[model samples]
Target: MPTTNDELPESGRKITVTEAVRLTTNWRTYLDDSECDFQTKAFLIPIASIKNLLAINPDAEGVRAYIGLNDADDAMSGKLVLVPVVDGEDVIFLPGSNGDPDVENDSNVYDRSQNCPPDCSTPNELNP
Candidate 1:
């Protein structure tokens, strides 16, 4: 059975999606941490792409989506889907998934643009 970081052995590492799901059943907490609670909700990662992440970091902790750093007026919000890439004892966050149209065109203009980057001029690039 899979275990959370707090429940693992001294040499244990972060859990992968498969192991995480097997243990938690739901990916909500993982997803939430990645997204960083930016009023935006939900996360989407392709199953196939996970393999590349695994290859790069076999002991990766978990994926997270960056919701932008704090800025003036706290209006600088953007999404950066990431997968954990562990390098030795350091855990790095690697970019994963892309923007969703639904989020980009959300009824709330603030939330809409908040989810998209100003320089993001293209559609989401899906890994086929």
Candidate 2:
């Protein structure tokens, strides 16, 4: 489901605007089925207006903001989750040169579905 400006949370969205306008977030997703954990959620917000409303620099390059499921400050494990947007449309998160998902707590080859962040994009950029 898409998150419209009207649906923006009443709290935690630190930006405030005095004008009357509807800012709909162009929400996209790279949800890796059977991957990730309960500690996070990942998606793309591409609408320039919505980005501005969220206090992100609309002119800034790349998607650098992520909603934190634990802290609500757009990060998990002290890292920022960044997804890729090409031509204003969201693409799959590409992994950085280094990525290591933690399944060691109960590591199992069959449990590979739980490899967090889907082995794409660095740990923080793609993982929920």
Candidate 3:
């Protein structure tokens, strides 16, 4: 079944327009099934728009966004889904013709705060 945007919960934290854009554009897959195809370009617009909406309000914590396929189309449709995570146990199903999208949450969303400067964590950083 396709998840409607109305079904998704609103974020509790206020996300900056810039941060939201970054989130979608720089989205890293925490987990992806081999079969699910990512429509990178197609999804970028919706991802950015949704992020912008979330950014308006701060304090919406634990909110993650993802782009998944609709069963009807294998191509990326730019459908942005707002996924909420609880203690990292949210199960997400990727839109597919067959099996439901795999579910995984919070524990999967990347933490930007922990990102270290290039030189701090990598040997290349030290050399550079």
Report lDDT per candidate.
0.43, 0.33, 0.39
User: For this target, which candidate reaches the highest lDDT against the unseen true structure?
Assistant: 1
Global lDDT for candidate 3?
Answer: 0.39
TM-score of each: 0.30, 0.20, 0.26
Q: What is candidate 3's CA lDDT for residue 87?
A: 56
When sorted by lDDT, best at the front, the candidate numbers are 1, 3, 2
Predicted candidate 2 versus true structure: per-residue lDDT over 15-75, tens digit per residue: 4332211121111122234443433333333354344323433332344344334344533
lDDT score of model 2? 0.33
Worst 10 residues of 3 by lDDT: 110-119
lDDT of 3 by residue, 12-101 (tens): 345565776565444433213334454242222335544643454233345565644344464443344654444564423222323333
Error of 3 at 75 (Å): 0.3
Cα deviation of 118 in candidate 3 (Å)? 34
State the RMSD for candidate 2: 16.4
Give candidate 3 regions above 4 Å deviation.
Answer: 1-39, 42-60, 91-128
